[model samples]
Target chain A: MKYRHLVITDPAKLIFGTAPYPVKTRRGLHIGGGQVYSELNFTLPVMSINDQTLPEVYAHYRQITEGALERALQLNSKGVILEFETLLEMTKSPATGVEIVKIMNDICESFYQKHGLASEIRLTPNDLREFERPALQRTSRLLEPMFQLFEQGMLAGGDLLSIESTGGKEVSDEALMMCDIKAVLFSLAVLGVRDMQFLWEKIAALARQHGKIPAGDSACGFANTAMVLAEKKYIPTVFAALVRVISVVRSIVAMEQGAVGPDKDCAYEGPYLKAITGIPISMEGKTAACAHLSPVGNISSACADLWSNESVQNIKLLSGMAPVAYMEQLEYDVRLMNTALKKGAAYSRTLQQLLVESDVYTDAQALVLDPSNVIRISSALIQGDSYVANARNGALEFIEILEETLASGRMTLPEMELSYIPVLREELQSIPDSESDFIEMMLPLLDPSKFIPSEYGL
Target chain B: MNYILSKLLEAVEYGKVDQGSPYPPNLKGMDGAHELTQKALDAGIMPQEILETALIPAMGNVGRKFSENKIFVPQMLMSARAMGASMAHLKPFFASGKIKARGTFVIGTVKGDLHDIGKNLVAMMVEGAGWTIVDLGVDADAESFLEALSNNPGAVVGLSALLTTTMINMGEIVEKIKENAPGTVILVGGAPVSTDFCRKIGADFYSPDPRGAVEFLKQLAS
Candidate 1:
């Protein structure tokens, strides 16, 4: 009777198109539906060209610079994010990344100078792989000039003065190296270098000591440095006191902000609590809330061309030619659970098994013990990607399960599958709606003449 | 290249489909690839010459330009369409063995990924280079790849996936094809696919562009 629209949802009254469940239960993790996860900033120039020469890449930046700067200004962002990794891959050295920082700084400086824009613009560096070299020695090579610019009070030209390496990797090696990196970051932060990011690692352990909700800081250094800026406190005192904030912020965000529950999600990745706590996140971490004068910049990159192509939905096929600026938002926790549950079934493990068996548990092992808590906490941290990755793996595993079970008459999906899919499609359709400029971007490519559904007569 | 084949080359490069096709409007009303290819054949031009000297070289230029970003997807697609128009006339000759095709090539986008643009481009470019292409379309799984290889013994198989999620699916398809058709040459590609991925999966060949695959096939035939 309800087959007319195919996708059915009564959002206010129904959970799963009328299957009743209490509000925002942890059990939501056991089912599947469309999820509104963070649509990340898949900034332009990702996967646009393969096997590119250095000149080609630089030419690509020049071609897109006007458009990119215009979009940044429209968004009121301090500056833009660029894919320096491409250049680094071309050079294959940490010192090269630093060299690229200077090149990028030149680009930003020229953009600001030419535009005659009064507000300073910066470029955010992302996907930093250089954990070791380009040390204080190398940093000073670039920094000394910046310090001179600051001394001359002519540092207003937006340049990538900051560095970001998402903590806890090869960057997490030693007290000496970590201290060295932090020491350089601190010096640059002082001399009007822009805010750097991915400096927060193992922040959960630190959060517990401060009686904060134990959350790992994927962007740890944000809250830490924000506190320093807030207290006008000695930088080391705040850095020493820094702990994970996203989970705490998420908890407060979920409880205090009613919009972030079962039905509603934050319209943008607003640091609502960061405003209250006076902790800066993201670009704020870089700027120290503009507390530090004209800090260095960050020029990060995006991948997959997934969100980068502005016309992706209409294009039927996306290439890097017409790139769109993108940003991400944290989906309501309930939605993450439901998505992990339903979509994850086709992957390596069920949501329950994912919690019990897979490394999803150990990913947050020291962080938390509860499965639901792990989903909430780990999903906000670096561990979330692996969960989605697990589902992708589950997609392959589900194929095997379907094959073996269908062959042996041992397994069939729960009967709810029929009613469930339309909702899944409906939820997926919302992605385009939210990204209205490229409304069709998230939809799978379709050619009725050629594309046949995997489930035909179900 | 001879005059007729040279015209064919220009037609493919500029995406002049046929005299009737309105694309590449400057070339409209002129003899297009469809007409020029036919004219070459009627003038006693060998099919091998049309492919080697004209079609292959034209597609090679297109591929090089693509890598250089002188052309993008829409342009590449246009060129592929023109190439297809010409290949339509040659397919019959290859079927009858009047014109020798080096070998058969079975190609498809892997299961779970529906993107066909890249796959289609590769297929068209490869076909232009004189191989008989059996395109299985998108969402082709390991079983389908194996079946395609079985029907065309000694043919090369190409698997494509655009999503990182589905790129893993390529590994399964490659492994299955290798296991079932142990001797079949496998070429893997797509946006995310790298030569490193090719080596990791034990696939025999990987190309970022369709021209690379075509050149690899040509080398094998030689």
Candidate 2:
């Protein structure tokens, strides 16, 4: 609850490579104070690993990590963050994830201790609870292994504990397809908020016990899902944009429950999270083109403390391994931003403006992410009385900015999409301000079997 | 066209599920697909005729609007719901063999993946096109697909995965299925799936949208 109101009220004051509050890792890596670090996210190629392939899996990870670090040194990057987002099998076999954690941490320490360079690891285990139908069984056997892996990762000298926990995804999946804003809000603001509270409480406690940084969670399973659907033209981009804003309430719960800054890279809602909580955020933009195609390639980096490549595989390319190539790309991107930062405040502001302007008018998803609009939407978020109201107001604020943008002839959207704005506006405005009333109204419309109300403490 | 049948078509086209649902503002307070469909049945219209002339065409229009970007997932999903309401009244006819299905389509999100919105959408669209869908649900492994195929011989199997990590499982699943059942036809899809990947993975088809999958199945049935 550190943020009662928006910390950076004036959008002009908000800049990349720094946050009002920065998170310092155990190895003296300051995530948000200054210097935009490159957070390299890499994964295995299209291969299955079993008991017989365990040794090969280790070899692949070693190659990717060693190759990436070698590139970092060549680029002369000041600091880098290696995010080891474990695959599902890694979590199932906790020893495998822990061993990989140990291997990555050893490489990072060796690089730092020998080369006088700094690096850290953000160990994210896949949230396996999402693999189940009910998806929210707190006591399920599948749930504990994730936390066990996190604990093991911390003990293995991993600096950050994070997970892309998919709490409300089961319900959000259906709501997203129907564009049911109320149901979407319930899934994210109510069900997701409760899950974040329960999940992050444990994670933050574990971090405290281990004296490690509990980096934030993401709405990747929710908003990022919508964005991908929208990108494929299956859903309206405006719907995805609104979902992104509303997602901040649930994601910020990670912060409220004692998790500190430098939230996950894929949480495109990171801008709003950063604006409200003053937590440094890791954002992936142009460099993330290796993972997925997105229109926010430029705007995503406008307020980022860590510029990331979403996750490239260890496959080889003309230059070298894919992860190594991506590390080089991320280093250059961070170098430009860090260079702007070093020059002075004016240079940083100019660079931020260029990043904002490059992608703002091209897409609705990008427009809502403009740092100035993030401040405005986040301000409305804090002023609201309840989580549901906060999510509603956030969506309304996003619509207002979108409408203003469209009305001013700054951006032109397709007629089909343009017509849906008023429809969404009316639907958002129709929602009751009280959380209970909103829940009561939405419960009947949602398939009771699709979600367990008791899981949300209804 | 019969008035009730025509009204049922409009209801499905506009996504009016029932008289209680307040969507497509213009159609509020009107008898929706649920009511019109029942009235059409009571009027002695053949279930297959209603499905062929009204329900199927209505979903076809919805899918067309979706592909053309005139409508998106929400509008199309509403239409799917309206079609579902109408289909409920026709299920007895289908079970009694009074109406025929095109073919069986078995689908699931691959192992190590739980995302199913896209898979569910394909199921809905394909089912709306008059096919029997055996949904294997999410995290369905290779054995699940083989078991489903053995149960429904000559069925088309569809595999889906949202993450690049889990999508690789599709290749393994496809390989296992091919090794066990050489002539099995498989379709693969998801955000990361491309026609190129489809060919590389030995899948028979890959469609970026549900409408394209329906089209491919229609031709296969033909």
- The candidate scoring highest on lDDT is 2
Point out the worst 10-residue segment of candidate 1 chain A by lDDT: A298-307
Which predicted model would earn the best DockQ?
A: 2
Note the B-chain TM-score for every model: 0.86, 0.94
Q: List, for all models, the DockQ compared with the true complex.
A: 0.02, 0.65
Relative to the real complex, the DockQ score for model 2 comes to: 0.65
How many residue pairs clash in model 1? 29
Best by TM-score: 2
Per-residue CA lDDT of model 2 for B1-222, tens digit only, reads 888888988899889999999988999899999999899888899999999999988888888877777888778888889999999999999989998888999999998887788899899899889889999999999999899889988898899997777898999999999998888889989977899999998999999878889999999999
The stretch of ten residues in a row with the least summed lDDT in candidate 2 chain A is: A131-140
Residue lDDT tens for model 2, A313-384:
889899989999999999998999999999999999999999999999999999988988988888888867
How do the residues A255-281 of candidate 1 rate in per-residue lDDT, one tens digit apiece?
221211111111011122222221112
lDDT of each: 0.41, 0.88
